[model samples]
Target: MKRLVAILVIILILIVLGLLSIWRLSQDMDVYVSRIDTIQQSVEQKSPDLSLIAQTRQDWENEMQLLTLFLYHSALDEMAEKWLEVELFCREGNYSAAHNTLSLLRQDWEQLYFQELPIPQNIL
Candidate 1:
């Protein structure tokens, strides 16, 4: 009887662990799905403001020239800055502008970034 109880306890613990893992995964997936939905809605409902993002990109590119190469490694900050600009563009009734900002940011990241490229990891 003791052995059976021990086995049952172990099984219960495993079941609990499995349930927790699945719950966590579901929560993460929900966030990811919500964020995707937001992006899709923004794209479909609003237009992109290419001009604004382009201007911001140009300004950043020029500013990058003034900074030393050593600090260039801080791509995370740049990525965040560009992301915020894109979000702001989207908020200002220019989905196209946000898309443009994201495009330029992606280009900059591809060309000048080497560290783990930050791709807005927010789930929502």
Candidate 2:
């Protein structure tokens, strides 16, 4: 009887551990998915504005701040490339490019997400 009780306890512990592992994995996956959705929404809302590019360029020129320039340049380049691709896709009537661009943009977001990984300051 004691042996059977011990086995049941062991099984319960294993099940709990398995559940905990699954929960953690699901949580991480949720974060990645949420970030992807946010990026895609942002991309979809983009308007092909040369003014944005010009403004960013002017900011870089006036400040001589390498970090600002680097970030704005990189984002501008990506946005422009994606915008052009989207225009071409629209001309060709291919809606798939819009979706594909979202995937590509998600990859960019993923890279940034991993680089500046957020940590919860306080656990509620």
Candidate 3:
């Protein structure tokens, strides 16, 4: 029937849109992880690069806006606080603290990335 065909079409469109959003989120998360790794390396070398952290923080703020569409606000808020600590520690020339904070931030992002995937565990 035409009604059944229309319903199927709508379902197909929804599935496509869902897959596209998941793909976009995965890409963004990958970029974020890469940036965090860069910061981690800089901090691990006992060279807290304030300039790099500042630039990354600004970019993350913009990215966070987009992330809100997919992730929970609470997850984003926790990461925001960790990011602030990393920036502050870097500015104060505290490489150890900055490294720790960066690690925590990376873990949070990883968790979010894992949670967003369309895997069997996540669906169930």
Candidate 4:
């Protein structure tokens, strides 16, 4: 029937839209993760640059606005806390602690990034 076909078409469109959304979000997260990796590497240097701490914070602030659209607030809150810890460590000249926090931040970002993807396991 025409009604059945119309319903199927709508459902297909919705599915496509969902997949596209996931793909776009995943790409954005990949870029953010790479930036975090760069920050981590910088923090691990012999003489870590504290300047990178401020720059990383600013980068997260800019990304958070767009990220909030597809991510949970609780996840964002946790990331913000971890980011603050990184800043604190950097300000105190604790490169080791800052490096550790950066590792945690990378893990958190990965978790959040995958959470946005439409994996079959997630759907089931």
lDDT of 1 by residue, 9-54 (tens): 9989876665444344334444433443455455566754445445
Task: List candidate 4 stretches off by more than 4 Å.
Answer: 1-24, 69-71, 116-124
Q: Candidate 3's error at 79, in angstroms?
A: 0.8
TM-score of each: 0.35, 0.33, 0.70, 0.63
Q: Model 1 lDDT vs. the true structure? A: 0.53
lDDT of each: 0.53, 0.47, 0.76, 0.71
Kindly list the per-residue Cα lDDT of model 3 for residues 6-118, writing each as its tens digit: 99999898776666656666667667888899989988887766787788787777766765654445777778778889999887888898898898898888886676445
1 against 4, candidate with superior TM-score: 4
Model 4 Cα lDDT, one tens digit per residue, 48-99: 5567667767767766665555444576777877877888887777889988
Best by lDDT: 3
Candidate 2's C-alpha runs over 4 A off are 1-67, 70-76, 116-124
Q: Report the lDDT tens digits of candidate 2 across residue range 6-109.
A: 99999898766654443443345455456446534543555333443344335323432332322233543564465456445544545566558657755654
In model 4, which residue pairs have backbone atoms overlapping below 3 Å? none
Which prediction has more favorable TM-score, 3 or 4?
Answer: 3
Tell me the spans in candidate 1 whose CA falls farther than 4 Å from its real position. Answer: 1-72, 112-124
